[model samples]
Target: MKKWFLISTIVLLMIINTNPASAISNAPIHWGFTKGKNEQQAEAGKAYDELLRKHHAFYKGDPNKKVLYLTFDNGYENGYTPKVLDVLKKEKVPAIFFVTGHYLTSEPKLVQRMVNEGHLIGNHSWSHPDLTQVSNEKLKEELKKVKDETARITKQKEMHYLRPPRGILSERTMQLANEEGYTHVLWSLAFKDWLVDQQKGWKYSYDNIMAQVHPGAVLLLHTVSKDNADALEKVIKDLKARGYTFKRIDKFK
Candidate 1:
């Protein structure tokens, strides 16, 4: 009887030791930007693509296609989204707007316009906290509140895409979010469009965007930038000239 009890305890310990849940690491991820069209950049992009593929997350579109997926991060209303929406409407381009709690509560009208205009609205968390630092319960609450509220207001039930705040994500957080039925969306190309005070003029915006235009690019533009608003129309036209087509994120993969 004593031997049987000891053997049972040893087996239980082995099972606990090998449990997958116990192996989850909560380390933070430092996202690095892939810069310039060099071999190094290409390799980095490929590695990133593999990482996303492993976790079923997305940072860019299909590399074999001449398609661009456009997304905007809307943390707050800076009085530039309406103009951005107008340009999108005029261009007949579809985009995804990742909105935080503040944007949803303060700019319901704009949110409604986005849905009505056939643009996709994604969850950008409730308070824009670094999800990696939050507890799993808080993470679920953050995502759920925004999703519930957005659905309540927009009458749209599908809001499965999640863009981590400030573009920071960890392996554990990504897995947690995926378990909640969200596909994490990052960006292949993003500039300093979010810094309002560091505006480099519309020309700088135009050149920066145009120079990096590539196939299967997931382009992130902050809706709060005046320079982005000013250069949006011309950028779209230029992209068309280069034979690139705009695709919605849902259809990107």
Candidate 2:
């Protein structure tokens, strides 16, 4: 009887070790973007769009309106977010900030300020790993860690949106995130704003952003870019001059 019990325990351990949910897949397609003259410019293709819709993900919104949803990916604070916040406040524009574990732990005050100022704080995963390469267990943990911590710091119970780290995602990853009650939020417009030294000046940033302005554009700007911070006011002004309006991601529909 004891021998049989030992065998059963071994089999149980093996089952746990080989759980199918712990498996990872090599996702074939990395997210891509194509610059175009209108809403078609940032299309992620029909297949991709259907897949995202199956999992309730979004990169842009309301293709018929000239509205822009602004978001920032905050992997870490570089002392420039305050300026960004200032610009948003002065302009009365709303945005979402996708943050990591380090950003939450290191800049609790800034995180709090973001919450206080009526900006949405989203989960960017704990360590910013490529979720497409991780097992469902690890993927959930990565998202949950940041969500729990952000809630702890900001006193908010729900973090409803996620931007997959490095913009890497798979269909399975999106399904798992959806099961965890998150809407995957990707972007329609992004540039080299994350690299501090590679900044091409505020004018260059302004021109590039304006050139791509479209109906329902979800613009992803890195808060760490001083060029972005400096150019935000003018960017908003120009966008408004062109009849564009800023909106929060929750209001995308």
In terms of TM-score, which candidate is strongest? 1
lDDT per residue for candidate 2 within 149-211, as digits (tens), equals 988988666988998888888877877888899999988888778898898889978877887
Clashing pairs in 1: none
Each model's C-alpha lDDT? 0.85, 0.86
What are the runs in model 2 whose C-alpha is more than 4 Å off? 1-28, 38-41
RMSD, candidate 1, Å:
2.7
**TM-scores for the candidates:** 0.91, 0.88
Judged by lDDT, which candidate is best?
2
The candidate 2 region of ten consecutive residues with least summed lDDT is 20-29
The root-mean-square deviation over C-alpha atoms between each candidate and the true structure, in angstroms, is: 2.7, 4.7
Clash number for every model? 0, 0
